[model samples]
Target: MSARRPYTVRFRTPDNNTLENCFYATDAFQARLLAMEFNRYIKDHPNRIDKIFSAAQR
Candidate 1:
């Protein structure tokens, strides 16, 4: 068995806004994988990205 670690997924808007969404992981590789997946998800969904930033108050 291995020890667990903490990780954070940061979602940033084009205008420099950021959101910290964290999770627990078992290793650095897992954390990096999660970040990549989240990034890919956002990239694949343009409308969602627009909506997320547009809905935010500037």
Candidate 2:
């Protein structure tokens, strides 16, 4: 397996509150996939993810 690094997921809640979360992943694409799966399990909002990026980028 590859080493993981910090990544950020930016999303908006149903209430319009923008939030960001940090996760560790091998790459940006994996980070995005992780966020999508996480969003699916959220009870209040299943489509909250707006974008994913390497922490270094934004």
Candidate 3:
């Protein structure tokens, strides 16, 4: 029998220009942890708004 693989989830934006993110988790709890970390990143770096807008203009 083959070994079980860990669970993973990806969050993406509607526009294709921005960088995509992937979250890997061994289980549901880990998945939640990953999501929380991602959220914190967004909150801390609000300047990403400008980057996305500039990319769209190009």
- The candidate maximizing TM-score is 2
Model 2, residue 52: what's the lDDT? Answer: 79
lDDT of 3 by residue, 1-58 (tens): 4332343433334453454334444444454455557766444543342221111123
Question: Against the correct fold, how does model 3 do in TM-score?
Answer: 0.31
- Candidate 3 residue pairs in backbone clash: none
**Candidate 3: lDDT over CA atoms?**
0.41
| Pairwise TM-score winner, candidates 2 and 3 | 2
Superposed by TM-score, candidate 1 places the C-alpha of residue 32 at a distance from the truth, in angstroms, of 1.8
In candidate 1, what are the lDDT values of residues 13-56, reduced to their tens digit?
66657655454566645655555565765446433332211111
* Candidate number that wins on TM-score, 1 or 3: 1
RMSD for each of the candidates? 9.8, 2.8, 11.3
Which candidate ranks first by lDDT, i.e. highest? Answer: 2
Q: Relative to the true structure, how large is the alpha-carbon lDDT of every model?
A: 0.50, 0.76, 0.41
Candidate 1's C-alpha lDDT?
Answer: 0.50
- The better-scoring model by lDDT among 2 and 3 is 2
Q: Which 10-residue span in candidate 1 carries the lowest summed lDDT?
A: 49-58
Candidate structures ordered by lDDT, highest first: 2, 1, 3
